[model samples]
Target: MPRIGVLIDNNTLDDHLAREHGLSLVILLDSGDRWLWDTGQSGIFFDNARAMGIDLAQLSGLALSHGHYDHTGGLDRLWRETDFTGPIYGHPAVMTGRYACSCCSPPRAIGLRTVNRQRLASQLIPVSDTARLGPGLTMVTNITRQAGNFEPIQGFYLDPLGRTTDTIPDDTALVLETGYGPVLILGCCHSGLENTCDHIAVNLGINRFHALIGGLHLKSAKPNHIEETLQTITRFGFSEVYAGHCTGTHAISSLSDALPGKIHPMGSGLLLTFPPSGHSTT
Candidate 1:
């Protein structure tokens, strides 16, 4: 069986849980593949890993879903503190400035501060399409929005002055080809969860996701958007979903109703397991 650990997120339930101001995940593949999905904004990678009992030296690789500070904030610490020597995966745009719209104007530069930028460059691999991180595990690099009704979540806007762009396409996910099915792990899914899954299906040349983990970015979804997402999930036939981080209570409830016990809430210290060939029994 493969093990997955939540290294960082927005909320921790107890001494056994950790909730911070950002999101990060540690993925353990059945093939002995290990990775740090996203790093939180605290930049306390060592402390967090020790607290969670995750040995940083054991990681096979490090991947960033995007360049957002919340997603890549620990880069400097990881590079400066740990002995981890691995390629960091993400789109090239991660190196560019990011911004959000404000007051109906072009937007403001919301990219990570200058110091962090230099550190990220030192560790970036900038993958495309699919990068096989290890046996049976591939990173889906491009996520597209095919549904017309699926709008980019609000509060995200690009600066027209050329200072910075949303550059969210840089956001990505991970796919593990376990015995049960392709276990999909995402960062923010800022590019849209459906889009990410669709890319995975096409890239891996298979349908039927065994597990869905990570942020769905449905915090401010509209009625139509929610309905569309529900319909899409039903059509896609995901067996299980563990969603959180920017996902609202209403959205979680809706997904729970649609997916029943298959729907679960993920937070810091929450541990999910999956047999090498099937869904996790416990």
Candidate 2:
């Protein structure tokens, strides 16, 4: 069986745990290979992990879905706190500068911090294509961008002035092979959920995805876009969908309504376990 623990997210399941606008998940494989996905926006992940009784020092490897600050902010603290000496998988462009400017607000840095960048250089394992983390665990990088309507969000830039549009090429997802099917672990899904799934199906030769657990990044999408996304997801025949973080309330509600019992609410402190070759048990 494989167990997934939500260490940090936008919401908390317990009153004692702290909530933040970020996401992080700890994956425990049946083979005893533990992997840490993303780190959230700050040291809050560490605090939440402590409350959840998770030991960071036991991690076998680390992987980042993207370079967004909200996803990589705790890297510095994690480096300082643990003696983990494992490869950190991510795209090469993850260390570049990135910003968000919206509604006349000044551009704010949204990419990984400079300090963490320097710290991670030695351990970082850049994944330009598909890379196997271990048995049944793979990192899918550079998702095919074929969805014409699934454009990148506006006001995001690689430059401070917001002149150059940031396409978020570093966006990636972790695919876990289970007995039921493949489970997708995403960060923000900036590459469009449909597009990401399509890449897994066509390029990676994965026919069906058993579950989708993580951010969808549909916060600012229009109603029609959400509907279209739901329609696309329906084709994947996923048995379970646990969404949080950048997936806004409206999008989650819409998906829940459309998918019925398949959509599960996700937050910090949530624990989900899946049998080696069967359905997941919450």
Candidate 3:
């Protein structure tokens, strides 16, 4: 198993810590294998990485959890700053036109960040089903719907315009396999946490996961959804859970109470080491 390190660079919180938009994560694997899960909204990315001591230029590639601005905003800086010749991964819709809606109101076409899009195509290695990133490293492509009361991720709406239809399927995630066990990483998890877990379990043909890092997409989850999610997670029996991003504070607290020590706080500059022996100063 290899060591996995994650940095939550962007978020939905405002200046006073209020929810608004979202972002992605920067995950680093052992053997100097590095990846950007999602770039984040823009201004804060590079600085955030520096503050966290993450060198994006050294990253092997950049991955988009989805096509939202908050997730892809940092691509411009990355393309401008580094000679990084690594592949970026994501669904094709990430480059296509999309929209953001408000209370089922008129659709506001999501403004395309052309520069970033171009950089992604030139640099990205778009994946659909599944692909081996590096040794023992794989990205999941199967999307499934499990029988349970847990609600899927919500509030994401697409518009059915001229050539575009409401297509949010571009939402995806990343999974890393370590020496200890497989660690599931997510961006927004617009798919579903259970789906993500189940897919990984089936694809890898292994049930036990050492840890689950990244967003569980529980911020908007209903009570039943939360309860079912917790139950499902308990069944998987992950040793540690480092979650945040789209996961609300209230939900995190509740999960913390339910699981006690198993829950770990995830933020912009947090590092988690594997084998339970690597020293983490932060």
- Rate residue 56 of model 1 by lDDT: 82
Count of clashing pairs, candidate 3: 4
TM-score against truth, every candidate:
0.87, 0.95, 0.83
Among the numbered candidates, top lDDT falls to 2
- Report the lDDT tens digits of candidate 1 across residue range 1-282: 677777777756456555766778888877677788877876654576787777887778888877777777777677667755677778877766666766667656656543655556776788877788776667777676675756454565456454443537777788876677777888777777666667666766656777887887787888777777777677677788878776677888988886787887677776677767643211
lDDT of 3 by residue, 141-194 (tens): 535656653434343445534334443667676657665666777776666777
Poorest stretch of ten by lDDT in candidate 3: 11-20
* Candidate 2: tens digits of C-alpha lDDT, residues 4-40: 8999999888888888999999998887888999999
Whole-model lDDT values for every prediction = 0.72, 0.86, 0.64
lDDT of 1: 0.72
List runs of model 1 lying over 4 Å from the truth. 104-109, 113-116, 147-153, 160-167, 277-282
Better of 2 and 3 by TM-score: 2
For model 3, state the Cα shift of residue 166 in Å.
3.9
